[model samples]
Target: MAEMLYQRDVYGKALVELGKKNKDIVVFDADLSGSTRTSFFAKEFPERFFNFGVAEQNMMAAATGLASCGKTVFVSTFAIFAAGRAWDQVRNSVAYSGYNVKIVATHAGISVGPDGASHQALEDIALMQAIPKMNIIVPCDGPQTREAVIACIDIKGAFYIRLGRPKVPTVENKGKFEFGKAQVITKGDDVTIIACGIMVNEALAAAENLAKNGIKVRVINVHTIRPLDNDTILKAACETRGIVICEEHTVIGGLASSVQEVVAENNPVKVLCLGIKNRFGQSGSPSELLKEYNLTSFDIEEAVKKVIS
Candidate 1:
């Protein structure tokens, strides 16, 4: 069998379908409607769509206002703006008010390709996860992203959906979905690699590579960041003697930080984090950026080998 390459179009189609059935599910964008692909919803439901130019702060406030009117408003923008620029509005309005607002921030991490550091959102998960009443989700691929959009529609309070620009492979094909839960893709007793978003694919690939060397590695997708899946994480840590945390985002406050907190209190294991260090990425293609920032499958393989050794 061959590996699959996912597309973002599937998520757009799912959003269109959800908009047809749920009138309360409104869409908002910050000028980059085409880039984020929320324009599909805008075309289908013009009456329920609002574009706030490049004003991400205004868009966040407006989404909160719309949510106040009993609407499930989904505000879409580049992750950099949705979480970084509009952090104040998101924290005060949507999070503090516990509004039914969904924030879909695309182009997360170094996967934004040639756009480089300015467009890449390396701290979105950490930034949004810090807010109270915020549900943070980082779907692995297009199909999962679609499921995430549907799940966010009725999820209570405020939520953040982190998306990447690069097409990511769908790790799960079971056609099931849930919020605030981690998906354990594979089982192993040697080591566990907990990752999310685009890094999920890399982690799985690394696990396969490690298997050839007689180092069985388990892979878990911690898609939901805010409500850290403590149960699954601790279970994996206890089962696997050592652990490796991976993500496209910065290591400071991303998946590594989340897993570290859980392991500190519950299960202690030799842990390694694979992500961009305290450095900015230069302009390059997505693949090039991954290599430059050490966010590739090879990097994960090397990290696993090092941890085991």
Candidate 2:
């Protein structure tokens, strides 16, 4: 595995670099800058950093106001607070108006660990996906997260960039990021595994394990959830024997649902979604929670086998 780096730190550092180049860039955090690593931007651009002190809704609204006034606003908070608690503001104040506000939410999924179910945002993607004109990006690793942050600056309208708390393995550093494109990490014909966020690393490990057993699998990193790579997904479905989706989020409206929608409409194929099945998270270590929720590489391998069977 490559050297582990926290996604939040990468995003924070990237924001600092962006700020140095663009005077219009401003950052807002809901009293969790330290945890979300937005403090890096705050430290360098103190005048542009606005700490909202736990008021996520107000922070989102304020972000909209700043964006309206020609500021490239980046808002940071826990995923739960950003997507759940501030949904109204995000929808009405940002997405509805097509504002250039980037919502970089950290601590998403069960990886939030000891913070428990309340903090873990298993349904954040679903919530954000439901809103019109809401662009969603779930970076797979540190490098991808940094690239995504930079990409968001150029993308117009409201954007939601989901990030994790733990130091996940850096999976993709060589590939260039496109807003609606999926990267084919490995090519195969027997099965295709579509994954995003930290689960992309797990999917890669699962593919390696399956290869040992003579099961060829294709691994695709679907970092962009909304405006999904429909062409790539359809091509994988048509070429591969079956498809599997692995995510650290709920199966309802995440990458699994997005891929299934594409396959069903274009070319029907068997799909096994490996993720939290209509359940909430709990307090535990990151590893312990992942094991308990069956989100490890072994689980992804099993799902692939099931889909191919």
Candidate 3:
């Protein structure tokens, strides 16, 4: 695997590249330009960047207004504020109006170490998934995050792209990313592992370990949470006979819930959802938190075993 890179930094650089190509692109940040990495674009296009002094709701409303005036607006902030604080504006002004506003929130999930439960956004995915006409993308690595940003810009609608704060290893699958398509990284007949965001890497690691134990596993990256690739998931379920979903967020309304909904409706199979089970995040290092919450590769391997058994 390549050296780890911060997904937020990749997003920031991607925005600068997109800004140069599309002059109509505008950026807004809620006093977290540096942390969110929007400062890279702010430096390049000062005229098109707006810093809304910690007012996430106002910033989202303004982004919707800018989109109304033919501008492709991209808003950045912490996931908690962007999805929790400004949820009303995002649903009403952005999704309801079908505005071309991209909400690229950083520091998502329990990875925002040292911030405690309040700052970490364990329910952002659940909150955003409930909104109609809102697209969601949770990229796993730096390269995928960059591609996700470009894809969101090219697509016309309201988008919520969840990004992480910690640097993660680059994904080995160097394939083109299509919105609403799940990439199958590995193929197997015993079980299937579906994951999004940082959990994709964990799933891959689990598959490798499972291979040593003579248990074949298929690993899929469900980068796009909403508008889920039901066809791919159904194929995996039919072929593998069982499924295990791993995610950094809560199991309540995240990738696990989405996958279960599809599996229950079409192909009923043994499904194991590996994620936080009705709990809140706590202060710790990213690695420590992941282990504490049973989000590591070992946890995924165990989940796969449980489903297959």
Models, CA RMSD each: 1.5, 0.9, 0.8
For candidate 1, write residues 1-309 as lDDT tens digits: 334544346656777898889888888998988878888888999998888997989889888888899998888888999999999999998899888998888888898889778888888888987887789988888778878888877668898888888766667542366788888887788989999888888888898888999898888988888788899899988888788899888888888898998998887889999987898767899998899888899999988888878
How many angstroms is residue 9 displaced in model 2 relative to the true structure, after the best TM-score fit? Answer: 0.6
lDDT by residue (49-145, candidate 2, tens digit) is: 9999979999999899989999999999999999999999999999999889999999999999998999899999999999998999999999899
Candidates, ranked, lDDT: 3, 2, 1
Q: Would you estimate the TM-scores of all the predictions? A: 0.96, 0.98, 0.99
List candidate 2 segments past 4 Å from native.
172-174
> Residue 19, candidate 1: how far off, in angstroms?
1.0
Winner by lDDT between candidate 3 and candidate 2: 3
Report the error of model 3 at residue 10, Å.
Answer: 0.5
- Most accurate candidate by lDDT: 3
Worst lDDT run of 10 residues, candidate 3, spans: 168-177
Q: What TM-score quantifies how close candidate 1 is to the native fold? A: 0.96
**How many angstroms is residue 148 displaced in model 1 relative to the true structure, after the best TM-score fit?**
1.1
lDDT of 2: 0.92
lDDT of each: 0.85, 0.92, 0.93
lDDT by residue for model 3 over 210-273, one digit each (tens)?
A: 9999999999999999889999999998999699999999999888999999999999999988
The lowest-lDDT stretch of 10 consecutive residues in candidate 2 is 168-177
Off by over 4 Å in 3: none
